[model samples]
Target: MKQDTALSERPAVGATPTGPDPERAAPRYTGGQIRNILIGLMLAMLTSMLTNSIVGTALPTIIGELGGQDKLAWVASASLLTMTATTPLWGKLSDIYGRKPLFQVSLVIFIASSVAAGFSTDISWLIGARLLQGVGMGGLVSLPQIILGDVVEPRERGRYSGYLGAVFGVSTVAGPLLGGFLVDSPLGWRWCFFITVPLAVVSFGVIQWLLRMPAHERTANKIDWWGATCIVGSAAAVMLLLSLGGKEFAWNSPVTYLFIVVALVLAVSGVFAERRAEDPIMAPRLFRNPTFVLAGLASLLVGVSMFGVMIYFPQYLQIVKGMSPTASGLMTLPLVVGMLSASISSGMLVSRTGKWKIYPVAGMLLVSAGFGVLSLLQVHSSIALVGTGVGLIGLGLGLSMQILILATQNALDRADMAAGTSAVTFFRNLGGAIGVSAFGAIMTNSFSSGFRSVGAEAIAAGASPDELAVAATGSPAAIHALPDAVRELVLGAFNDAMHHVYVVGAPVALAAFVVVLFLRPTPLRSHT
Candidate 1:
């Protein structure tokens, strides 16, 4: 069996190495190499988030051109679905195959798919491309974290993590603006997708040159291909069910029931497989730690609230509030700023004091409170008030989301760090997928019913009565295009929809807050 003993076996200065020493095989990065790695990883991370946020400012234009405002949630959900479901698989594979190849391959896949997406002429093609791109994106996000885990000890990992948080902060702040500008310019919305190509090409080249790691030598054992297949199948099915339920299919329909049954069976099989597999995608043993379990749950909830909220808020600003793409991006600056502040502050505090639980505990409280406050938003509310609400939510999310991962990694041994971290990340992303689907449905249904009640065209000119009703609630565009009487009706419908969505999110946040209360405090580990 191969073992990594490189870290412990470094010789004294000028010492000679013995023949075939295990230490000789460990990948060592020079300072320049490390810089290359960070830069490469940063580009990859930037690409992972860029597509989603960029779309936020471009959505109204894209939907208007593509004529699929009704399918808007799918744009976000598609990327999240593949990214979330495949995360654990990516982590496990990286462990078996080593990080360099997986990382590079992920970039290539993302780059290729992104280019295809930019040229897509219709919504279906774009959504399909996004799904493919998401598969690559899943690895970019997860593999970098795993690679960081390999090089850094848990305690000092926060500094690198702080770097990652900074990347996320910058991307979230910048993605919408870049996306909006592309949409508004002669380049058009397609450029938003094309923009990732050059960045990815450079990232791949950098990683290939700078990341020279020893081959991962493992005992000959059968890969649990079936288990991985089942897990992916199960995750995809469940996400699809959630995304389509109450929108495309009735919750109680035979198709929905069939999908539900398949999801459950495959998920159960996956659990069993994880326990028995030599290298499980998600090791069952990690959940044995109570801190890991709670932190994972908290992470999941945070993803649901945090990602779910971010995906749609720009649309709310642009469509409902009559803001332009640039103005809408600017309006969201507070949320990004708040996230940056919370992440930096929490990281510094954790590093300085080595006390970490307080942030997530308090953060969750603020999350619930923030969402509760956001629920008060109305069509007539001031932009500053709306930004304040979003910023508060961002602050809570920043404080809690990554901290839970940090706590979970700290609680586990070095060997378990990647799996544990990936698990929490996977579940969180899963929660994001579920939340978007659920809340999207809630908004759609509420808007449709509300619009119908007010009689803003029981049927639209080009759309079905049901479709017209949904569009009325989805954005301000629908309302803006209508006559004054109909516009007022659509506005009322949107208000009801937003209110209901917030109501759902608030309770989920509150429940997460209660869950955090039970988490036992563990000191953050001092190593990578």
Candidate 2:
């Protein structure tokens, strides 16, 4: 790997270089110090990402025991809602108070919430704990990246970003497996919450010990309380609308319109509050930066593609292929492997070359192609074909995910680092939230239509209406239990619905590709 001339001349170990702008440049750390700091950050990141997904496989057992079948989805939605709402606030707070203290506070909150979640005697308690956990999770997700930008120069950031990406990929794969294993073992489902406690403690200790950075000297000490309120309220409203809109109430119902109106009002108020605040939660200036805007747009679109497939593919595996939850997770290993490989490799390449546009460009193309391949999947499609489609999607995501952040961080002024990083993250997460809801709505509609058509044919073929209805509304096991002829028709209907999902996703990926095409190719800076 060829090193940039400036990077090659970096200050010797333990020496802080006062670059052209000492105030803006991060404290130069020795390689060992950087490694130690990253270790703590990675552990915290692992805990955060793992918490997001680990509950997935255990939800069934949770509902079975807690008896909140109707409230099952809130187990996931509660966390996501709070996380999204609080992310920008956490970032701004970090910028104001300092990263170390805020980060440790988040860890403390996370640990306490995990313990609370583990002790939950009812679904409501678990949901409340999860919501608190998400508030901490918001910091865990954005702070490490912000801190990384603070510690490493852009030219070398890619190499470390790759490591974070690898951790993300690992956590994504491990969460479901760990959750399933815990549920199956004598330890049971609660341990899923307990298991991360030790990791969070270790991470908290490590960060407190090894991570040290120069304090930021702020121009203003005023907290943007009104801006924060508006931002949080707006985000929470939008998240609630997305999570509960089609399920808890009809899309055209008064409740849906109320949520929409509340979201818009809060959002509009947030923009005005940000513009008028002494220290805005999400700096209004970030919107003026073309790189931030373009990167955020691309990130949002990528989020749609990424989360839509992640949430639905397992269903295709379990519902159509008759795989168990564990088996479905195992089947997605190809996607994780491809993502891990591409993320690490791309990060290394960007570090070496200090060029990143080509990767996301290629990545979006691959993602578009991946969706095309997946759209062709049939009820009897081979495992190899399924692997190929998901693997392609994973590789594309790996190539693009961290690079977008890298690009945004590189373009931002030092003062805007935390707010900018969080904004990009906010967009990606918001996109995921929107995509999941939208795709789910699409799947529901398409499946209902296909199931209705198939039911007519099955009834004509002498299948009972009650049995067909049961299969349509019941679990995968219920669907598979139907007679051979009816089962085939139901599975075909499901397969077609999934096909429609990927087909719709392909254009979204292409839109991301188009958005990235307009991103200005600012060279990665050699100084922090």
TM-score to true structure, per model:
0.86, 0.95
The digit string of per-residue lDDT tens for model 1 on 1-528 reads 122244344322112234555223223444455556778788888888887778666777878888777788687568877887788777666666666777888898899899998888899988899899989988988777777665554555565565666667678769988986788799999888899888888888888776655545542266778789888999889888876677777898999989989999998998898888877767788878998899888877887887667766766776678887678778877777877888877877777777778888788777777777778888788877797788888788778876787778778755566667778888888888778777877877887788667663534333346545555546456657665555555676777788888888888888788878888777765443
What would you estimate as the lDDT of candidate 2? Answer: 0.87
Candidate 1 deviation (Cα RMSD): 5.5
User: Runs in model 1 with CA error above 4 Å?
Assistant: 1-36, 55-76, 121-128, 456-475, 481-489
lDDT by candidate, in order shown: 0.75, 0.87
lDDT of 1: 0.75
Best by lDDT: 2
Query: What is candidate 1's CA lDDT for residue 521?
Result: 78
**Per-residue C-alpha lDDT of model 2 across residues 137-217, encoded as one tens digit per residue:** 999988899888877889999988888877877887789889999999999999999999999999899888766554444
